[model samples]
Target: MANIQFRLQSSTKEKKPISVRFKVGRKTDVTANTGFSINEKDWTETNLPKKNNDVNKLLHKSLLKLQSFLEDRYNEALTDSTVIDKFWLSNQINECFERVEKKDTGILANHIQFIIDNANTRKVSGRNQIGISKSRVKGYETFKKIIEDYQKTAIKKQIHFLDINKTFVDKFTNWLINTRNYSKNYSGKQLDNLKTVCLDAEKLEIKTNPYIKQIEGFAESNEERFIVTLSFDELEQIRTCNKITNDAHLNARKWILIGCEIGQRASDLLNITKEDIRYKGGRMYLDVIQRKTKKSVTIGIINPYVVDIMKNEFPYKVSTQKLNEHIKKVCEIAEINEKVEGKKLNPEAKKNKPETMRKIQNFYPKWELITTHSFRRSFASNYYKKIPTAVLIQITGHSKESLFLNYINQREDKDANADLFMQFYERLNKDKEPGMTVIRNAQ
Candidate 1:
């Protein structure tokens, strides 16, 4: 439901400017002038043009049409969760009236929408669609909300692309970090999105700040990387758990074991089907063309439990989100609750409010940190060195061994390397006297 009204704020004998007030869900109530005027005496009690004359009746019909148009537009905005304010409302009025003076392409919100509108069909390399990912679209919307909140609370005005400069960024960053209590990584993402839209505007031949190119994004330090993986023993605990009776939990447990043995990303692993499994030379293999990197990989299913589950009842497809949730519950039931370093939901944060609970870093129960990503990291750690690094890299779809090694917590086997060197020396000295230069003996 929408509540949009066009009325004069003060009654007078002379014609008064009609103001448009738009409100939805008690969250927004903004006013803007409609650029239509009428004397207060000419209006009916219902705020329509008086029906006493033909001109007034025609004016009433035209106003009704405009009202219907605005209502339809508001419905579309509500469905898309578009950020709305006095400026946005005013723009709608201006657009309906066909006035271009107040319409500025420099506005950040307008430019973002311009990009989004075109993104639906934007193709990359004539094959894949760009900016069509739900995560990316939702991310841009969230970024807009952050900036809107910033302006509302701190600046009390709309910001434009040309307004983006060193000074504006300084205040924006400070307000995001100190005032809003947002993390550097999250705030940096918002800034990065702003830079992206500004660049997009430039490509459209729209004017933008000259310093937009100088704006840089940031990330967390490499040393502070948060890694969460289940060990072999902990994974075994989950495997042996018998308390899970819920079908959803059972389905998630199967995915956890299969994902760990296969060493694939959530997107690729969750897309697994019975048809993807193949039998080659008496060995079971699951084939996948990696979605993110578009790499072809065939992973051997060696774990007996995984092989059994795949053979018996292939997991009914579960969403990535549902799998993450159910797996945590399964692990908790198996008593994998050791306190470890990870991020968890903030206890004090308000529910249903994304801005309230940013992130809290502290030691949480092991099960609390478990996610779909944990299965991949767990596979790498649990079988490191037991399996050839090159083979594992292929299974994981990593481009290089170095990149694969950095993803897991396992250390290099220096002892095994020494043993190999000793064996080499013994073979070289076979059936011959070893030559050694003897120095002074230590006393």
Candidate 2:
């Protein structure tokens, strides 16, 4: 049996809260507040509240109730084979009061609320900064709404942390794909977000479901749908197009060109200002600290078209949504209408449909496939052969060489390979080095 008792907390002041301290076998002792305060004079050596008056009687009753609650939890832990340590005891005490008071405790819905409430003002690690982006907070809210919807429609019960097992994960993924019509990648991201919450909960010593750590098959392959990037000729066509009439499309055209030249996300691209530009060593460059990665980069403005936009102070303040909408119009005006294959969510798929690589082979207008992100892809692809990859990664903020290569949809170009081979052959023949004897004999 566990040794459980209530005692007065030490305080320099006249009053202090009472706390429950317990010991199980030979383990280190544990203590937690009972959430009731009393004067030191009212706490006797027996650790019982004095029952001299109505207020004292109420305090005594509350303390007795707390003791009974702890005893019951300790006995329950022994029967269930749960380790009766400080972490377990503390969580038990919290749960007990929450039950008595009819308050939501550490359930999934309440944990999500805690995350949403503190989403902003949460510190960024390795820096003294506070608060995350508003968009990120909105993402948390969206996740909470999805969970709430699932509870209302399917589960018909409150979700607990222990409910996040393999079965729960599979059901949630199916719901997102079939009921919510979320794309595979988007659904995977939502599951990733839930896993992130579970990790945070574990840090708080919450007893999490084991399946949260062991679940598999959440990642989707990128090979099925080809990454679309604008070619140099396509970019030139958009730049030379003279038919843009709307102000928004004209502004979006300039922003797309800027994104293509700078190789940054639309979040960072649309926030550029005159103050961000600097002239160094007889050349102009944009000095930017990326919003997402929080990394600094210096991009030289070598393109004459981009230089003109900076010189004329063209508006770079368009919202990302407007830019995505208007850029397609601009690309359409440029006649970039070639069909490209990509993935789209199937709206007609029924619930419980087994997840498969559902690649539709229908052709989409090139402009239809174009998004604000295409600008960054176009920049990476067009300049990948012209510049060293290391230098390009420094400007594009790609942390890995392989990731950058994949981002540009790097593939074997037969003509490019032939040109490279010919250059190598000429170098070997012209130099006439010792190792070139075999090559010369073959020629």
Candidate 3:
């Protein structure tokens, strides 16, 4: 039972009637009478009958009523603990009644359920709802994977819902940050979902929240990792390799090369047909609106190298996955040893069996590295080195300078800087003949 307190005293104020008094906590203070003081001045009795009465009479009656209330509460407090439990149950029922009376069930599960149901409804609702795109849904699916894995361990027999504790959160965060190596933003998203679920749990009274203080770090790490962009010579090797004999595939290679020349995401390139090309305002260009960001991007390539690839290549429906494979194969044939991101089409190698690990994507775990996105990263890094930041921003549709700079490969920067230093050293040595020492005249 809760620690009980009741204030009972007579008010000397004229015309006030006796009233019952009860207070729950230090926050709730009571006047001498059963009536509560409105702020610091007037008092109103809760138990008084509806009537027009003077202020003093009201105070007196309210105080008397308060004394009665205190006696009742004190008597109940002295009763058996089991009886107190019964009283609590009754109070909860009364609270529910008050909730119904107020008609404020907007935040109930039924409301969310209704919204979800309506979103699923065909035509009228489905099309009208703020829909998540297929790409966004794919992102959500990835997020859902983490949620499902977390639920498997966090849920317990005693709780109908997930028991969110510090341990569970710590594990999930570690899995994302250390194991999966997801960025802080992505990890925060998983935590956000957990927080929402916890709030829902509170509403349903399924589980009590213990980790109320979880706040994922907003401070970004100073560690700047970079992608490796292919050098011009390496790109030339891949482009002109003799290994590709299939005309259609060779043409696809041209498109891939064109994509490299003018940085465009694979998703955007997959839908690019001849119709998107335009010759307007005295220059030829491809007007592309990016699928991921829905940002408008235009590429103006007057170079015959790119135009020749575009013109000679017969359009083919090359899947991004297949394109990545061909690029890898072409790179291998050209003796290009640079790392490019691509996914493995093979299943996870069986533990303790090297042969089984080499198995393809069908049998068990499917893990692929170097996905198609690497090409985009490579392109951005490569061009940002050669072009001005402002011009690159226009072609790449990067709205911010930081975002544009983020794509630059740090590895490439290191290599380029080293090469520059070597060239400078060579120039200095050449200017001063290595062993030619003129006999210094005594001056």
Candidate 4:
């Protein structure tokens, strides 16, 4: 067993430094600085601060945490039969306070590499069998590449942890937006990943810039961009278009129609197989587990067009990148060329050339805006008015009604509200007796 207590050092009439005294067995005793100070009158014999203010509250919390950490270290050392001397106790205290020094102390790039390696191979704590997803590993790799590029092009030198001050953060953000041409949301995500890495490094006793906590990342405002979704007429036009002759284009069109009807993500939509479609009680249904959410959904196959596709061969194994490209080409050929406002990367813009970066509000042809994801948006938007919101959320896997509504871009229209009010009124009056009608006079 080890005994630990907080004590005050000898001083004059002013404040004195506080220290922790540790005693293990009868032969070993040591004292380590708590790195805190207070007036002699402000501390009580119970080894707790007596002041009732914010500063005292913070000191109290730090002391409790330090005590807990030291006790844990002491218990672990006991099991290993480690030396219980003053030097060992001092080293433990230094580790708790993150006072260790190393030759590679604050290399930002090295810390990022550590994070990437850990994310790639590490499992969630307490879940020994499950490792992190490959997508997350790729995300960390992407952020590492961005940092390396910035270091080479902008700074021309390696960045240290201490170099990540507010000025550096601001410059990096500007470079991401103006030079890299990244959207505000995506830039924010990258900055957030960097922040996460910094935090993990700090936990591992690595010194870092204090100003990292003071920085704020960019966020997207609702007014900055519009949520684009295809209307019912546009989807109908794509379905009835006769200009498509190429087999690849025809396959892309069929997949788009299936996606709009099923409302699953492209990752899950493109992987559907004939075995996933089942016949139950003489009705066809799609049984699928969403790849992203892992939530199983059973969709009734009622659309004749979708049934016809299923009767033949469905879900042609198309790569997501190729699907996006082919879908845009199919939409363009169908003459779905209405002008719609959205965001798109400028083809001619070169990174590191700020002059070529365009503002986000440039309108483009809707066919050019169509991607693999547009089908899901089209399905959610077109069917929301016809089905109950809760039922639709079950199919779309939306956890909240507001989020589902926003995803479909379905704001409350005045005509729709009036129709709902009339339906409610009719329902309420239908149960009334025959002579219960009231007459009103017009002014």
Candidate 5:
């Protein structure tokens, strides 16, 4: 006889996921996530909801429903020689609940799920199995949820690749902007990810709309948003500020100085230890692979400020949250009070709501706007025109110069080579009379 049971994974006072256990006779027991959670206090020792409230009652009903459905499915599969395992149990659970479509279903949402599930097997440029990061997988999950919501509210049905067309794009973008409160940039990113998925689907011989080739997402121009950067003088102020009496602030100050000097992202910069540092040809460097892009970057310790800071002692390792908080306070003490035009993420924004439109955009003092991100931007901004663009990009570990320029919020001057052109013109004119026409013999 087959039996099903439910249990909580932890005794924590907070909500915890319900674990589903399936057993057949003997030695066939398996445990899986029920994809449902309940508050610890509301759970009974008998592996059931206490039914103290309507929500718990509903939770109890859902578990009972799953048990009934799974029993029926198992009985049906017995005659068909279906293997009973965690995968089969998971598929059954998903089919019983629309958490995702059945594994057999080939729809827009299903393809996204496939990508999310098989992200680890994904390769870049057909070689290394450099999978997408966990955050990226979470991003895809969020986008999938958004798609599911859009289907329920607007499409009123499942979205298929064939159903993706000009009409769909128009309706989707409108719903994202007007109904979902997403900014143009946020909406554009979602559509862009959709296009990438569509392209990936095509490679798999999946049916898709031909118009997807022409499909494009709309976003406000980059020129509209301000790129925050600290001036050399401002960085110096933060670096030399003596008012930092607290130990936390002192550690963060050292990190801020090193961050701006090396121009590395927070994850890469913070995880660096003394063992990662290398000496080559009388220079110090930190060799690391960028957490986001997976690119190998060797950051040279060229700045005298960072060198001096590291000379006495290396900064203590701290969480990114603590580092950001301490740096903001350090900036305030340094009197970086100049109001700057910028937009920042709203920590107080409602969960599951997009931080868009006017909620995040505003002018605030330079100190208030400064964050770990400002380190790289300030590094790029300060050294942009001073150093050769190519050399700077190499140091910044950017794959492309154009992307490097855009990252630094710099536009290349169109007439940058005008002086060279003028010199060439003068040399050409100096070799002959101004009005003379010279012709070379054909060889």
Candidate 6:
């Protein structure tokens, strides 16, 4: 009895089905029935002749298909008894499809967040929630902490919009550079993440964003050019430490070295298993998904030396942070003596103190301001010097050329530049050539 019948509204003589319209629950959706959707509202007011047979038939079929699709989706949404879950799922799919129909916008961050959150609630609710894996829950905790910190900091700067204005964006850029001392590329990435969150918020009506301006760019940092990457000596130091030490702490050091070789984040490397590696095409490689970006990343292990070390250290399960600590210890043992950040231990700190104080006092290395992330940066820097930029970007999953270059550039290599210029002058003056003068090399 429902007026849910599909009818073709185009010319009856036209053999090709132009459009089909169906009515449902005070609303209508139309399709070309050619595997694409069209707005029925546009066709409904058309002045086409009513006696068009071909148009009528196509319209009827389209209505039926749309009705069926909606019915199925509706049924799926209601299969669960939880009203909140059903409403969330149904609304998200409907909104996404509606946006698609209108060709309104590109993939928004809020849409992705909706899907992820819905998946988590549906999959982990009830008794099963208690069984959530430690790794996944830990990742969620990390994500929560980041969001909390961002919100707290950004709110102080009046950046509460779901989508930020250009002014706030510029301020954030300055904050990262002048305040955080982040390199240009690093600051860009952090801002990019903020942009993603804003766009996601836009989709949820939490913010208004359709940033009219192009993303801001920054001048490249000269200091980045001088960053020293891990040399063969550092790798040897790590490998030797692993060979001599059999404690769990030492095993963590071994994994950290492997992490450096593969150029993976500590979190991603911590989750690695024997299954992630494959020996194919006469070479070995790791197939991994970056935890932060959820992007697929693959890395080849060409160095048989590092490969051997990984194989030797296999079958050990350790926390990523613990491995970081052990790497610092190993660095100290190797007389690398570079002060790296570690957790500060206040042996007498009361349990009643602020939770922040509970954090293991970070090991602040006097010579090197190092953290777990340095291993990843060191790996990228080491490879960029030895490999082509394009190949390195592919391995590291870096989308921006500037970022890829910045990863390898060291800031402390000012002396190297001076030395090069010195050599150039010396060459110019040699043998009294045309542009030659008496050149004295620096002692």
TM-score for each predicted model, relative to the true structure: 0.66, 0.67, 0.52, 0.64, 0.67, 0.46
- Runs in model 5 deviating more than 4 A are 1-101, 319-322, 346-348, 354-359, 414-443
Candidate 3: minimum summed lDDT over ten consecutive residues — where?
Answer: 359-368
Q: How well is each residue in 308-367 modelled by candidate 4, as lDDT tens digits?
A: 898786757899889888988989988889898898766556464543545456789988
In model 4, what are the clashing residue pairs, if there are any? none
lDDT of each: 0.78, 0.76, 0.52, 0.78, 0.80, 0.53
TM-score of 6: 0.46
- Give the number of the best model, judged by lDDT: 5
Evaluation by TM-score, superior candidate among 2 and 4: 2
Model 1 lDDT tens row, 1-443: 77877787674548877777777778888888876778778887787778878877877776787788788778766654456777567666655666644257877876666656666665543345454555556677777777777767886556677667777777788887777767777778778888888888898888777888988878665456577988888878888989988999999989988888888999889888999999989889888998766689998777788899999978998888888889999999989989988676665565655455566889888999999999899888887877667778888888887678667744466575567667768898897875787999899
Across 320-424, the per-residue lDDT of candidate 3 in tens digits comes to 768776655555556666443422323434243322322222221111233355556667777664665567777777777677766563332446546656776
Angstrom error of the Cα, residue 358, model 4: value is: 7.3
- Per-residue lDDT of model 2, residues 1-443, tens digit only: 76778878788878897888887667648887767789988878888888988999988887777678788766755554454556566656656565423234456767777777886777765677887777777888878877787888865555666657766788788887887666676788788878877877777888787777865435455575467778889888998999987888888888878888899988888888988898878788899998877899999998888998987857758778788889989999999999888654343443544343243446788897788888888888889867767788998999977788767767634465467678768987896756633444554
Better of 1 and 4 by TM-score: 1
1-443: candidate 6 lDDT, tens digit per residue: 12333344454443423333333354433333333333343344442223346765564454445556655544543442212222233333344344233222332323333434544453432333423344554444443444444445643211233225565566667766665444565466656556544544555565354462355555545543334335557767666653446586566566657767888777787778878888888788889987655568888887776677655557377765666566666666655665444344344444533222222424455223334666677788777545655676766678766776656653344355466667768887787747657989999
lDDT of 4: 0.78
Error (Å) of candidate 4 at residue 219 is 3.7
Residue pairs clashing in model 2 are: none
Kindly report which residue stretches of model 1 are placed more than 4 angstroms away from their true locations once superposed: 1-103, 125-131, 348-350, 385-391, 398-406, 409-443
Candidate 6 wrong stretches, greater than 4 Å: 1-198, 204-228, 241-246, 280-283, 292-298, 338-370, 410-443
Name the weakest run of 10 consecutive residues (lDDT summed) in model 2.
350-359
Model 3 TM-score relative to the real fold: 0.52
lDDT of 1: 0.78
Candidate 1 lowest-lDDT run of ten = 122-131
Estimate the lDDT of model 3: 0.52
